[model samples]
Structure formats: C-alpha cells, structure tokens
Target chain A: MPTAVTPSVLTRPDDEPTAAALIAAAVETMAVHGYHGTSVRDVAAAAGTSPAVLYHHFESKQRLLVTLLDRGLDVLIAATEEALDLAGDDPAERLGAVVGAHVGVHLESQRESLIGQSEIRSLEPAGRALVVTKRDVQQRTFERVVRDGVRRTVFTTATPDDTARFVSAACTSVAGWYRPGGPLDGPTVIARYRAIALDAVGYRP
Target chain B: MPTAVTPSVLTRPDDEPTAAALIAAAVETMAVHGYHGTSVRDVAAAAGTSPAVLYHHFESKQRLLVTLLDRGLDVLIAATEEALDLAGDDPAERLGAVVGAHVGVHLESQRESLIGQSEIRSLEPAGRALVVTKRDVQQRTFERVVRDGVRRTVFTTATPDDTARFVSAACTSVAGWYRPGGPLDGPTVIARYRAIALDAVGYRP
Candidate 1:
C-alpha cells in the first residue's frame, strides 16, 4: 500500500500558538479544498499566522492532522461511553442516549469529526495507523452497544454487524453535506437522527 | 461551479461496441480513480480499445464524464419510476417495494450510481444540470412517499423532508462499502433494507 512518510524538524521555539488553533485552521481548509488540494501555506494563511509559527507547533502538516484526529477521536469515544454510562442498566433508555450521543459528536465537533473520518489517509503511515486504531476502538465500542442491546432484549436488529456498519456510515457521513443552511438545525437534526437510528436498531422511540 | 461540458456528438456513427459500453467503461474507471485522477487513456484501455476510438465517441474526458452522468441519472430515474408505478396506491407497500427496487439499483448498477453521486460535480454546466434534475426527481419521489405516509398516519416525525434526506443518505452511501461478498446476498440486503427503511419512515413493519 502507498503511504506518506513523516519528517520531523523545527527550528523555532516553544512560544507558538496552541496546536488546537493550527488543527482547527487545517480542518476548515482541508474540508473545503480536500487534503491534497490544500497546502501548509494555505493553512497558515487561513490561520492568520506564519509558517514558522505553524512549523514550531506541528513540525509538518501530517503531524497537525494526527493531532486533530487524536483529539476528535478522543472526544467521540468519551462521549459515547458517557452516554452509555449515564443511561444506567436500562437497555431502551441506554439505546436512545447512545444514539443521541453519536449524533451529538458529529454536531458538536463537526470539523474534527469529519476530517478524522474522511481525511486521515492523507496522514503519514504512523499517523494513519494512529487514526485507524482510534477508529477501530470506536467501532468496537459501537459493537458493544449492539451486543448489549441485543442481550437486554431491547433492540433486535436483523443482523447486528450490518446494522452497526450501516448506522456508523450514516452518522459519519453527516459532515459531508451538513451546513448552516439546511432545513434542520443542530438539535433538530440530532433529534431526527436519534429517532431514525433508534428505529433502525429496533428500538421503539 | 466548474462543470464538464456536454460533447457535441450524442454517440458515434460507425461504432461496433455502442455508446452504452463506452459509458460503462468510463464510469468504471472514474469510480476507481475519481474524476480528476482518471484519464481518457485509462478508460479506453479498460474498454479494450484505443484513444482514437474514444475520441470518436467522446470529445474529451470532461465530455465523456458528462455523458456518463447523464446516462446514470436516466437509469436511476427510470428504474425508480418503474418501481413506483408497479406499487399501485398503497403507500406502505409501495414504499417497501421502492426500497427493494432502490437496493436492486445499487446491486445492479452500483458503479454508475457511485460515480454519479460522488463525481457528478466534475461534469460541465449542462451535464451537471442533467444530473441534478434526475436527483431532484428522485428526492421528490421520496418526498411523495413520506407525504403519503404522514397523511395516512404512518410516520410520526415532524419533518418528512429531513427524514427522507437522512434515509436516502444512509442507503446511498452503502454503495461505498457494500461488496458482492455475501454472508448477505443482494436479495437479503434488499429485504433487510426494506424492513429497516419502512420502520425508519414510520411504517409499522
């Protein structure tokens, strides 16, 4: 498989802007123009900073992406776990909360969520493996939800694995066409998605 | 919106293979390597022909894409319409049949469907409009299903439009990951999707 290789070097010191800002800028630019279509210079320009400052923090573009993907996946995994935890031992209520949290992750962390899912392959081999690991972790967590739901007899999907993959694909692809101009706003879209997801997973909302 | 222009010629005059074969080859190549990544040489090679033969059929790579977009949209619209017509006046049953037919379209013509949805923007002005028209038609037909469902007290969502959009996005993106690999065959996937979609749209299946 063809993979990008990472390089590490920076002449600047530790007073640079936070990695968060750089990753945010990279997210917007990468989302609009795609990963390859954007450059380090464009990211700097969009961030309203110099390449020297950017280099001081990230070392390279792929490193910046790695930072973003890690942060986003961290947020995603935590939110799903939190939702499941908060719902207690009840399968039906727990199922709805998990769906809400899944949709909420996309809405709250739209940019990071999108870039992590779609643009991670643009990262170098090491960075890509890191992102994939995080993704697999989340997928397994989702699988656990399905297994739990089935065990509790609250959700009875025809095929647990296929249902899980279908729901994950829909949830992840939200950032592709989602924007401010849509007919539904954040909470409304989340509610709608939660309802549909719950139903598809065989929960009665 | 940069778009590929329509070719001056509809098809070819002394072509033994026919325009349909040429369109299929172009779509296959485009799906494998997005619009910008594919070349006329790659498409011609796939078709078991030469560049001169391609030029006779398509004015340029852009024009060839436009033709494929036009043809893909036509096929989907025709298939869905035929499915609708076959279902008669029962909304829930009609919608189930529609879902089955929708999956059939994906299984039978996944390559064109994939390219048309993911790479249609590569088509020129007129060609883009043609694709959009067909898509809008599909969307409208879906809306009709939702409307009928709501009118008959079948669906409970506040907005049919968002529900339709979410369901459409969910099923269509299946093209990205769905393989001919079957622990679930075409009929099984279609059957599951029909049940899933009907419940999703508020049908009590």
Candidate 2:
C-alpha cells in the first residue's frame, strides 16, 4: 500500500513536453469541470493534442486522475515533513508548523488541492484504496504529533486520534473557501489557522 | 442571495410521490457516481420515471441538485439549532452540543450529506451563491458561540472566526468517512468528536 509516488513525477521536466502539457490540462479542466465532466478528448483538446497522445502517456482517464492525485499528495507530504523539521522540540510549535504548512501548500496549489479533495470519490476501487492508504500515512504524522503533545501535557485532549483527524480536516479545508488577495494574505491566514490549531488541542501556550 | 430554504422542504410528505422518488434516486445515484458523473437519464431511470416527470417538478438537473443540497443544509442547520437550545448557557457545552449534532446529522443522512459537501462545486453560479450564503449563516452560529466563549475567557483563542471555521470543517468531514456498523458505532463516534471539539476551542473546564 505504500506506493509513494516520486516527487519528480509531479514536476514538469523540460525534456518531456507531452506529459507535462497533459498534466497541466488535466489539472486545469478537472479542477473546474470535475473528473467526470472532463473526458480524454477534452483534455487532449486543451493540451493541443489528440486523444491518442493522451492514451500513449496514460492508459485511461482513471489512470491519469490517479497519477495527478498521487503526485499532489506526495508534494503535500514533503511540505509537511519540511515544516515538521523546522518546528523545534515543542509539541505545540510542531502542531502550528503542520497547520501553517498544510494551509500554505493547499493555498499555493489551490486547483490541485481542490481536485484532490473533491475527486477522491471518482477514483476506481484499486486507485481509491491506494490513495486512502497514502492519506492514512499523512494522517499518522499528525496523530504522532498530537500523541506526543498529550504525553508531554502540552496538549490535554481526551481523544488524541480524534484531535488529529479534526486538525487535519480543518487545515485541509482552508483551500475550499480561501481566495488569494482577499481580506487576508497567505501569511495572515496561516498565522490565524496556526493559532486555532494550537488552541484546538488544548495546547497550553 | 438570501434564498433561505425552509427546513420543511427536506421532509418527504409520502403523498408527493414524484418529488420524493426523484430525491431518493438522486441521492442514491449522486452518492456513488457523484454529481458530475450522474445524468438526468440516470436519475430518471433509477426513479422508474421519465425525464419529463423529473423536469415537471424540477426545472433542470442543476436545479434538482441545488434543491437537494439546499434541503440537506437546512436540515443540518435546524438540527444544530436544536442542539444549541439544549446546551444551556455554558459555551463549552454549547460547542459540544453543536459538534454532537453536527456529527449525528451527517451520519444519519449520509448520502445527502456526502453529496451536499462534494458536489457543491458542480453547482451553477446563482445556485452556488445562494448555497454559500446559506452556509455562511450556519458558520456564523459557531462564530457567535466561540466569540461569546472568548469574551468570557472560557476559551482562549485569539481567532474566534478561524476556530469556528475549523470546528465546522472538522465536524462536516465526518460524513466523508463514517460507515454504519463499523468498529465505532454512532454514539461512540459522536462522543469522541464531542471531546475533540471541546478541546479544539480551548474550553477550560
């Protein structure tokens, strides 16, 4: 179940033109029209290519979708890990770091994050299981932080597992409603959510 | 934008065969196939009726989807209000009551709730605005409670608005994952979430 997609697979290389174009077109179309609404031909047209070219790179539309989702999740995990590394020994600071990173990544990759959240239901059985397993790994990271916080008395939640789920869900949801250049900038939004996340676990600051 | 849908619209009158059948079919289909994946023909066929019959009650497929979502949100709002009424004057108790009712309502009406959350993006412009407006009103309820708690020093969050959004998002996400007859039953799930919610807002005591 640990089919950790390579981070390089997500990044567009100058050498691979078709695959890069196809991924971009898929993310743009699926983010707006949704997975079911966008067909291979629609993506192909958006990419200035043909359906045969799309099938050449990806076997089917489902495969293309799973690839996009896998890449997005991989990027998110990497960002979270980096944030956790920067966070010091304190559990509360670590929790804030995770929230800030979660919100930052989600807003920076708004379209992909939106598609990743909404289109999980569109994946086939096998794809869904793989994505769910990867998602569980990400959730475990948050759970571990919360457990450490509770053990140190820095957090006083009765249900650490539930707290992890709540914080993760809340952080991931920032992408849903947040608009860039709105009332608050990215830094402000991150700061506010970070405080809320710390407070959420009964973090004694 | 204030299309405040009446709560009674969600109830099935038993006498209204067409609308009830249509709603049931839509929920069943959309729950599995998603709003984008489902078509008017699919819903009509599932209901054992023709497209004309569906159109007679609902003007279009988009209209039907919005109607279903509006009713679902209205039901959730009413249930949350009732929970708040029973929670007495304590802000912490009120927060728990809101979370408990939120999880309970989402789990009870799983299909419609799932559709209501995931398919909101598929809504047309006017429909999206109206639904978002209605949703904001619900969020305001949580904000008001959190603000009151902060004023009383029972909650120590600097961002009451962010706390409301975080709690609402976390509670609403239960519908995305909860399965009936799973390892945890409805009451246990609700109770765990209640504790998590209470701790999340820094409720002291």
Best of the candidates, lDDT: 2
For candidate 2 chain A, the 10 contiguous residues with the lowest summed lDDT are: A1-10
DockQ of each: 0.31, 0.67
Q: What is the TM-score of chain B alone in each candidate?
A: 0.85, 0.91
- Cα displacement (angstroms), candidate 2, residue B90, comes to 2.1
User: What docking grade does candidate 2 earn?
Assistant: medium
Q: What level of docking quality does candidate 1 show?
A: acceptable
iRMSD of all candidate structures: 3.0, 1.3
Q: What is the alpha-carbon lDDT for the whole of candidate 1? A: 0.68
- For the record, the alpha-carbon RMSD of candidate 1 to the native fold, in angstroms, is 7.2
lDDT at B44 for candidate 2?
84
- Residue-wise lDDT of candidate 2 within B146-179, one digit each (tens)? 8999899998777888888888999888887888
Candidate 2 ranges beyond 4 A from true positions: A1-10, B1-11
Best by DockQ: 2
TM-score of 1: 0.75
Model 1 clash pairs? B3-B123, B3-B124, B4-B123, B4-B124
